[model samples]
Target: MSTSLQVGKILNNNNRITSGEIMGSSREGGGRGAEEDEFLLQIPEASAKVPKDAFHLAYIFYFTLGAGFLLPWNAFITAVDYFTYLYPEVSVDRVFAVTYMLVCLLFLLFIIGWAHKSSAYLRINIGLALFVLSLLIVPLTDLLYVKGTRGLYSGYYITVAAVALSGVADALVQGGVIGSAGELPKRYMQATVAGTAASGVLVSVMRIITKAIYPQTANGLRSSANLYFSVSIVVMVICLVCYNMADRLPVIQYYRDLKMQAMNEESKEKGPLSGSAWRSTLWDIVGRVKWFGFGIFLIYVVTLSIFPGYITEDVQSLLLKDWYPILLIAGYNVFDLVGKSLTAIYLVDNANVAVAACIARLLFYPLFLGCLHGPTFFRTEIPVTVLTCLLGLTNGYLTSVLMILAPKVVPLQCAETAGIVIVLFLILGLAVGSVVAWFWVI
Candidate 1:
């Protein structure tokens, strides 16, 4: 059969699966049941038709826009103590911890709402609006607080709101509310990879910018808090505007109609999976896939231990010596961007998800460890530079593969919940890693 026919058949099979209909017989009836099971495992003909343009646009938004904000924020939190000249004597760790806790709570709330079948659109809009509002409030707090005492609280609040917004956005985009038009024509798996790459690029660029414009004071390090606050405010506003524009696009309605049609067809072919059954299935999948989660956790822990020790120290030293760190930062980001971008493209075009993930992990494990603890680690800065580049590459690939594969590992209805669980695990790993680093002085 032609590829199109094959795709159509697969889609039909998926529709059947979406409904509660079982394709194979029970094991109690051994011979026929075994035959049916073997038949069902065969690849179906129908496949999802993903649009190139829509997929590309989604990629740009996720990588260039969403990631642009997220990555810098991550790096910034890690180096906030060094940038305290912008705020003074405040415990950056405390602020970050509080913010992270709030974000986690908010994510839990979102998961609860989703489980109850609440309007994801409303939840997403409210979350994103609050996030932007918080960002706007940051610069204002700086303007108002002459003593700078309140700035810490303001920063913490903003960071919390930002993290909440990210979680909301992820849910919204994945659930087909906000980015549906951009996503409808694309394969969910490929879109995920693209999004991850975008995030990597964003982080790289933000770090570079921080290094370039970092203003040094007599205390210890250059303070880019104001720059971060200002840029974030601008980006938040831009995102709000873009979101509004997206809302107004006629394509959104079309996309929604198509999505509803798909859902309706799925519902008609097979009854919806019951809540209990879905929950059970989700847990079962998680149990089966625990190894992937553990691997990801290890990667995050490794990053937490090594990145802060090397990158922060390097940036601070350069700033103190009046050397521009932008070039290094840019180089790091470029490598990261390339790695993620390539990985994403490969996953989409080639469909070798497991292989891609393994490649990323293999590269990261040795490169990241060597960078932090290697003999020539900091000698002449060459090793540090190479490590940074490698870190960017490995992280970029790992993040992309993880995000892309996450939703696929479970039922479509549970994709958002899965993503949330993954995020929580990642955060926990980061916390544990940071503590270990602090205690061992590694």
Candidate 2:
């Protein structure tokens, strides 16, 4: 059989074994053996230089920037637009319910159809591309087609698109397309931080521009949305151009050589773990980094669902000004950038994965508590904002740590599956936490 076929089989078997373990089956021992066999199959028989693909870097930057632009502002824009116009009566519970429902549906689709696995990279890139396109088009649709019709459906569509984009981005990052399993290069994390920081700056600038250009508007949601779409379109276009140009670079040639070498190695392997070991070898890979996954889920549950709306609502209630809210958003992103950069660089350099993960997870508890009660404890602007900024920092650091640790929890072959599983938990946790927070509000 061909080397690719053999390696594919090993990876398939590994996946099966891992799934069994996740399901609480007792076939973990066999899973481990399958994993080892798959690993051996992947190693090249002859030493070869590692590929330094230029497109790899370009893609990393592209996706990293996409992440930055997508993560912080997507929902915020929707919320801003929705609340600015219609449904002031809509409770936070409804927001959480809508988001949770969409995420759950997507996760279900992922599991039942193996959609994430089947079209991993395609799904991710397409999703991001669509999000950028949607941001650009939605406003136009509102202007032309909808013509002042801003209802739940419009908000729902926008929110669904944004959330789906996030899901796909998370999957891609987890799949090792951007950064592989094991130790990640510092440059990648740096790109992510830089992208996030850039997004914050852009949003702030965009707000100013929108306010200046369209002073007649009561709220800047539509203007901000327009700016977001335009900026994203430009950024994505640049990324696509760079990605194409990168194909011609010498680095790509090196990468192709390395890839070919690995393929040759896999062709020679033949065993239970060879050429379809992914299923069987999955659990052994996960067992090594299970704690990291659990910690991540805990962090997400506390952070994404509960903290965001809590912070936004509290600050809005207190300050009651649009400018302050925008500043807070920018401040949070800036702190997040700094925190993520520091954590990624530090952990990549010195700390063990578990230690790094634990520290990151522990930091979330304080942030969570602050979000839960900081408003009540501190009635003043300086103190409340400070706590909010700290929460941002913690969130930034934890986000980076989780991204780094995710790939480590599984072998390279099944990195995609590992990412999918991790994201499943993230979605589940966020959904549950959002629901719980809504209940608390009630």
Candidate 1 C-alpha lDDT tens digits along 19-80? 10121211111233353455345423211222223433433443333442353345446346
Runs with alpha carbons beyond 4 Å of true place in candidate 2: 1-79, 82-84, 89-121, 149-186, 193-201, 208-220, 242-277, 316-320, 348-377, 408-410, 416-421, 440-442
Q: How well does candidate 1 score on lDDT at residue 127?
A: 47
Candidate 2 residues 1-442, lDDT tens each?
A: 4433443454455433231121111111123235334444453321122234334664355345434434434444433543446434446334634564455436543542353235433544554465455455555665665444555566546644654554444344333233322222233434554465556556656665665576534345555555566666676556445434544454434333333333343344433343246444555545655655566566556655545565556554445475565566667766866776676346542225544554455555555455446665554556556765776676667656665556444434344455455555555556666666665441
- In model 1, state the lDDT of residue 178: 17
Candidate 1 all-Cα RMSD: 8.5
User: Could you say which candidate leads in TM-score?
Assistant: 2
- Superposing all C-alpha atoms, what RMSD in Å does each candidate have to the true structure? 8.5, 8.4
lDDT, candidates in the order shown: 0.47, 0.49
Give TM per candidate: 0.67, 0.68
Among all windows of 10 consecutive residues in model 2, the one with the lowest summed lDDT is: 20-29
Superposition error at 100 for model 1 (Å): 1.9
